[model samples]
Every structure is written in structure tokens, then in C-alpha cells.
Target: MWFFIQAALYDNNITFSTLGPPKFIDRQEVPNVPLNAPKPVIGLDASTKVATDAFDDLEPEMIYLPLSAYSHYRLRGRSQNYPLLYEYFDINPYSGKLETSRRVSDLSMLEIVTGSMRPLHTGDFVGLSLKLVYFFFGILLSMMIFSGMMIWTKRTYKSTQTLLSRSTKAPSKTTKPEPSV
Candidate 1:
């Protein structure tokens, strides 16, 4: 799988297929890795016995512990196979893994797939999906029904108009006035 391949070959300097290979650079030496790393702001609140706690301030975000501080982190006896990001946070990365993957590390294996990654609420996705489905089929059905109605109504209107026009027109075949004498 791509995840395993990424994990395995990422640690070593190796070339994969034309699909492009993972570029392996020693992690310890890479200053840019930490510099370029995106840290999403996380916040929390602490309550005192006297007052209800409110979120005080945004704290420094950390996804992965720096190599120097890895000892201070409580990674404990977790295996190397466990993602480094999860290890540092003391959070269970595997919480959603099984539902998200058919087997281990199957990123592409999912029950529902959208074309691109976008942040969306669960209800938003469900509602949007339903709306899209309804829009597609509903418009098609409406168009067909409208077309049929137009055809039927147009023919009836045309026929009635033709008859009305003919009847209303002065008779072209008016009989010649009979001789008075």
C-alpha cells in the first residue's frame, strides 16, 4: 500500500516507480522539517475552585516532539510503526483507523470518498449529498414532465386557435348577392 511504501521507503534513500519516489532525508539533520511544519492552534480552559474557567489563551502547538525532547515525551513502549505524530501527543491515532481502512494503513480504502479533501460537518456532507442527488434527478424528471406538458398544451392551444381564427374570420365564400329583380 502507499502508506507502507511511504513509511518503508521514506526512511531509506530509494527510488520507486515512475509514480515518483519518496525523498529520504535524515530527519535529525533537517531543520526545514520543523520550520515548515504546520502547527494548528489548540486551546483549552482551566477552572479554579472560585471561578468558572474560560479558555485563557492559545498555547504553542506541537504535533511531533523534537528529537532532543523525545525522552521527556511519554511515548513509553509504543512501537516504531506507530506514527511519530501520535506518539508525541499521547493520543490514539488508531481510533479511526479501522473504520477508515479495510486493513492497516490503507489510506485509500474508504467507504465514502469525495474528490478532494475539504473540511465539512457530517450533517453538511449528508445534506449536500442528498441535495445533489435530488437536484440531478429532480431536474431531469421536471424537464421531462415540462416538455411533455408543453407538447400537449401547445398542440391543444394551436388547434383551438386555428378553429377560433377560422370561425371568427368573415366568410370568404359568402354567396353572391342574389339579383333583387
Candidate 2:
């Protein structure tokens, strides 16, 4: 869950919510619509435009041609565009979208892992799996912290007991003979 949130924030170029509004890259621009226009209806194609108003609220990063299935590429910053950063798997055996990209062949394993210049999609099974993995690890980390505290407390109790015993014994041993006078 934390990974997903960080990815969301990083992709959107938003450091903090209070800093500013979120931004995204529109895959394509609506015809006759100005690029700088506010809240323009956006879509991949002309017919699909009428059906989906989902992208209407998002701030567009860039207007480009030949919009893909996953269009919204979140912005990294003012200087560079955020790379595509997701991988999808087909649940159905009969049909699946084949992974094909002009850029994918050029990407190294580290690049893919870091999402340096990769594109992310919403329906990515791998990305979703990672979220679940991180959640489990987070729980495990909390358990480890609790166990460590318990060990420290036990050690502290033992040390305190030893000190109390030594102090009491010293008081008894320091007593002087009353017949000295």
C-alpha cells in the first residue's frame, strides 16, 4: 500500500497534497480543444470520448498522438515525464493483451525494477501483487519491533532486581556494633 502511494505521489510530481493539485499526461488531445483549456473532455478516440468522462478532472501532462489503452502517464516533474511503470497479466486463458513495445526490448532489469523509464498501467497484476507483498512485510516488521521491545523490557526488569538485592544487602552489612561506646 505504501509503495502504491509513493508511486502515485512520485508519478504525479506531488511532494505533498497541501503543496498543490495532482497532474497527469493525457495520451491524446480532443480536436478543437485548446491544450491549456481547463477540464476538457478527453479520450483515446472520438467515439470513446462520449463514453468516458473519467479523465475530465485530471490535469494533462502532455497531448500526444496514437493513444494507447493506458493513456494517463503521470508527470514526474517540470523537466521530465514519468516513465511507464506497470505490468499486466491476463486472468482469462482464452484472451490476453500481448506485451509489445518498441521500448521494452531496450529496458534493463534495473530500469524495469526501479521504474526509471517504464510505463505503468492500471490493470497490472504484477504491480498489484507487489502491493500485497509490501503489506505483509509491513505487518512482519511491526511484529519484530514488538518482540524487540519485549526483550528489552525483560532485560531491564532483571537488572533492576539485581540492583535492589545488592542495595539491601549492603545496608545490612554496613551496620556497626552498638557496644562501641
Candidate 3:
């Protein structure tokens, strides 16, 4: 549990850093940038336009995607109005579009699980490599935990046996043969 929590926090930090500071813009102020523009302004205000170019300036190895909203709704066994909702977003690398409209239950477990490791639509060597690293790391962690538990159980059993043997013998030797009948 501790390891899981730590891993989760670490991933969250990496994601936060990759996305950078949030730059919220009113929907009305958004610029009409062409989808194919080399550097499109994703957000804009009265004074200046914040171009998608800003993301390019980030560390070359960092994986970043623009802000997206995702919604997942499942009726489950409940009434129509009681559906569960989960939200998230992903980017379209080709068109540079932020696709946020999705229902959580509509996605398969694999899609939801792998979404963070790489881009959904595009496959690249770097993304594959990163995913492999994560897979191996999880396996390694599980092995380490199993080995540690085995060691602990072995030591505990040995100590318990030693203690029982000593206790059983100590009483026999310490009690003077009860007064002879």
C-alpha cells in the first residue's frame, strides 16, 4: 500500500510538471487559430495569445498534452439520474485537438490504464519504451515484496520454534521431580 501510494504521488507530480501552470481562458476570448497552423494559439486574451508553441519549449524528453476534459458516466444498476461520472481528456497529435468528450465506462480497461503512458492515437518508439519500463518496474516491485515477505516468515518461524523448545525444556528441568509419591 505504501509503495502504491508513493508511486501514485510520483506520477501525479510528473504529470503536473509536464502540464505546467494552468492558463485558463474564457471560452469567448479563444482565438480562431487554424488547425494546421505550425504554431497555433491555444489560449488568448486581450493582451497576448498563448501559443501551443510554449509546449515545444519544454524538456525534449517530457511528455505533455494540452488540457482536456473527460467525462465518464455509467448507469450501473441505478436509475437514469444516478449514473456515475468520471472525466478526462486526450490530445489528437495529428490535428492538435484536445478531445475531452468521453464516458469513462465507454473505454475499456486497457484504454483507461494505458492512456497515461502514451498518446492514444499515435504509436512511437519513445512511448513504447516508456511503457515497457513501467511494466518491468511493476514486476520488479512485486518480486521484491514477495521476497521480503518470504524472508520475514522464515525468520519468524525459526524464532518461534526456538522459543517453544526452550520453554518446554525449561519447565521440565526447573521443576524438582514433584515430591516422590
Candidate 4:
């Protein structure tokens, strides 16, 4: 999977099949990993409540300590998006330990992915191109539909005008026809 491949090689700085056969980077110091467990929602629940709460204010969102990723909750900054902007904490149901977190050190993997999923100017170049292409096609589709509707409407209007003209004609002069006989 790309996720594992990214985590194993890219995150660890092991590149292959490119400029180098196998590239490795040594850390000046060892890294430390955090221990975060999932938590539940601390406040009210609703459609707007859930979505708005995440992006409304600068809150140190609670760690859902006893929930699964499906219902995982992370407090976010104002207008912050989870998959791209902020780090997340999700507790594994079986392990009861923090399982998934966003990229904290490097920007390659996250930028590579979210760039395509969402086309921000600051993402991977190819991904950004893909998103732009998708948007262009979407606009094209909308224009196609609107033009088709306009054509249909014009045809209908012309047909209605012809029918009305046929129904509302001036009466022929009866006396003028008798002169011919």
C-alpha cells in the first residue's frame, strides 16, 4: 500500500529506483515518539455542532481516550482541516494506544497526498495539476448542462409561439370570396 510504502521508505528517508540505488539519512539525535490515547467528545453533538466545533475556535481539542477512530474527535484551530492542516490522535480499540498521528516532522507524504485530495497551492506539483484538471472538467460539465438547458428552453419557446400563432388568426373576409364566383 502507498501508506505503508510511504511510512516505511519516505518517512524513514530511504529512496529507491531513482537517482540513488538506496539513500539513507542519519539523524543527529534519536527521535522520540509520543503516547496519546483516544478520547470522546466533551460537548454537545449535532451536524453543525460537530463540523463547526472542529473549525470554529482555537481550542486544545480533547484526546478521545476511550473511542475508536470511526468516532475519534480532535479539537482543531479555526478553519483548520484535519487531514491536511493539523495533527490527529486516534486510540486503537485493541491496543488502547495512540495509533495514528499526522506527519509532524516532514511534509513530503502529507503534501503528496492531501495536495491531490484537496488542491491547495502549497501541495505537490503533480497533485495540484490533477486537482486543477478535475476542476476544469467540472466547470466544463456545468457549462455543458447549462447550454443544453438553454437550447431546450429556446426550442420550447419557439414551439409555443408557433402553436399560438396558428390558434389566433384573423377571420377571412366572407364577402370578398363571393366576388370571385
RMSD of each: 19.0, 13.3, 16.6, 15.5
lDDT of 2: 0.41
lDDT of 3 by residue, 1-181 (tens): 5346547977787332223343433444344557776534332221011112222221122224434322111111111231222233333332334433234455666444544343322322334676677678779999999999999999999999999998988855466676876
Q: Rate the local accuracy (lDDT) of all candidates.
A: 0.35, 0.41, 0.42, 0.45
Query: Of the pair 2 and 3, which is ahead by TM-score?
Result: 2
Candidate no. 1 TM-score: 0.23
As for candidate 1, its clashing pairs are none
Number of the top TM-score candidate: 2
The runs of at least 3 residues in candidate 2 whose Cα sits more than 4 Å from the true structure, single-residue gaps closed, are 1-43, 46-102, 108-129, 172-181
Clash count in backbone of candidate 4: 6
| TM agreement with the true structure for every prediction | 0.23, 0.37, 0.31, 0.29
Worst 10 residues of 3 by lDDT: 70-79
Query: lDDT of model 3 at residue 49?
Result: 13
Candidate 2, residue 26: how far the Cα is off, in Å? 19
lDDT of 1 by residue, 3-120 (tens): 5655686589664322233223234522333756653221221111001111122121333232342111112111124221111112112121111101113223231222112212
Best by lDDT: 4
Evaluation by TM-score, superior candidate among 1 and 3: 3
Candidate 3 lDDT for residue 165 = 92
> Regarding TM-score, does 1 or 2 come out ahead?
2
